[model samples]
Target: MSAMEGDSFTLRTGLPEIQRDDEIEWRFGSSRTRLTRIAVGNITTCNDETFRDRLQLERQTGDLTVTNITNEHTGVYQLSIIIRNKKSTKRFAVTVYAPVPIPVIFSDTSQCALSAERSSRIFLCSVVNVSHVTLSWYKGNSLLSSISVSDLSISLSLPLEVEYQEKNTYSCVVNNPVSTQTRHLDIDQLCQIDCDLCFDSPEAVIRLVVSALISVAAVAAVVLLVNDIRRFGRTQTMKR
Candidate 1:
């Protein structure tokens, strides 16, 4: 089973009742370190630093509940019972995952303005500081590709191609066993103008303002030159 950090989960021993003189022992981790034992109406708990004060065991049913689980709590847990001089054991595998962060989608349209044969548009989906999660690209309701990572301290990224003149819905999805997040792509809003110039960054806005001013100044200069030429022609005619 899977759990997120700070959550609680139960591992069932599947035993309905404990008979008198029957012994039950709960162990955890890769080495099967003993966590707790109950026998003859007495309970003994291991003072191990990993499970100290964080685990509870049912006396009658032998079920275990772990509270405030952390990444270090991920491992195999075992329940051993002895009845009628016979011993039986069961194991439960637990996986604890960190919370997945929301993914950011970036459009790389630098070549969108080039010739049709040479231009290609790409979208990248990225998430930071997540683990045991998958980042995926979806076209409409179908999945295109996915990338999975188990390291929580690193980032993950997935990419998809956006064909020119291709009309379809796309989205980036980031998910773990406990949670999911999604970001939709607005193709129309992004491709309304030249893809290379579609982004309204501060630098792009400044360049646009400068270009507009230069165009206005050039028109004013042309209008003044035409007026000067006309005035010169009139002065020459009057002198004649």
Candidate 2:
């Protein structure tokens, strides 16, 4: 079983109620060092640096629980019970993982326009410093793409391609056993214009418009000057 850091977990023995005469003991780690013991209506807990003030045992049953679990507390645990001089042991394997981080979605076209081609816009979803998690892209309720990793301390990324005028809905989701996070992609915000030279920001659009007007005015002035020169030359030739 797996659990996130700082979370609580329980190790169930599935045994019946404890008897006063029965003896119970719990051991932890690879070396199987003693963690806690119960015998003759008395409970004795290990004061090891790893489990101090974090271990609990049910007095009625032999079930064990640990709170505020950390990576150091991850290991194999053993429970030994002696009933009528017969010893029975059970072992549990536990794994600890860091909490999943909130995923961030990025796009190369955040301030660009989209073309008719399907690959004109590319979106990337990423999460960093997470382990034992899955990152996925969803279009509405449909799953688009997903990547899963086990116990790896690295970032994960998933890419999605969006086409012009073909938007349904899109989102990125990152999740682990303990937590889940989601981010939605707004197509309108990403592709403000859908032309060859689309402007991302309103200020950029304004500048483009102003530049175009200036160019038109310059062209008009040049045309008028050429016309005036041609007319003057004709008059001079006639006069001569």
Candidate 3:
């Protein structure tokens, strides 16, 4: 059985309730260290301080529960039930894993976009401080690419390329044995970048409007100077 850390897990005895004459014992690990034993309607727990205050036993059901499980709680558990000289043994294999972290999708133009491929952009799906997880890129429901990390607490990145006008859906998913986190691609946001050049930018449009206004002002000034000169010449001729 696989369980997430900080959660509770129960090892069932398969019996609805414990009988008065029945004896139940639960052990842990390869050394067969005793954890709990029920005998003669009495329950007893071990003094293993490594799992201090984290073990619970249901007196009526002969079930053992571990609360707030951590890496130390991951191992094989053994259960023994004795009734009328008949002994039955069961073993449970448990694995505990951390919660999967959310993946972030961002543009990676530092080196990949140096070709000036304005129509297409490079993006990366990344997760930090993660281990034993798989990071993947998916186009809609189809898998595009993936990368995995094991045993090392390192970061992971998966690259993907798409057109600026892409209409299809995409998502980044990171998952472990028992947990998964997904981030949907917002083409208009993370894929959004500066215009191909200044000509298509809002600043460029503003500059064009300013230049037009300046040209009109200069033309008006020239026309006024020409009219003033013509009036002066007429006045001089009339006076003569």
Per-residue error (Å), model 3, residue 210: 9.0
**Which of the predicted structures, 1 or 3, would earn the higher lDDT when compared with the native?**
3
lDDT leader: 3
lDDT of 1 by residue, 25-65 (tens): 99988788999888997888999998889989898887889
Cα lDDT of model 3 by residue, 1-240, tens digit: 989998989999989988889999999999999999999999889999866798899998889999999878889999999989799999999988899989988875453335443667777889999988999999889999889888889989898888867989999999999899999988776534533223434554687689889999999999999999999999999999
TM-score of each: 0.75, 0.77, 0.77
Error of 1 at 25 (Å): 0.7
Task: Write the residue-wise lDDT of candidate 2 on 1-240 in tens digits.
Answer: 788889889998787798999999999988888988889979999889888899999988989999999999889999999988899999999988777777887776433654323435777899988778899999999998999988668889999887745668899999987778999988767655333256544565787899899999999999999999999999999999
lDDT (Cα, 0-100) at 163 in candidate 1: 67
Rank the candidate models, highest TM-score first.
3, 2, 1
Clashes of each: 0, 0, 0
Q: How close is candidate 1 to the true structure, as a TM-score?
A: 0.75
Our model 2 lands, by Cα RMSD against the true structure, at: 9.0
Instruction: State in Å the error of residue 177, model 2.
Output: 2.4
Candidate 3 TM-score, C-alpha based: 0.77
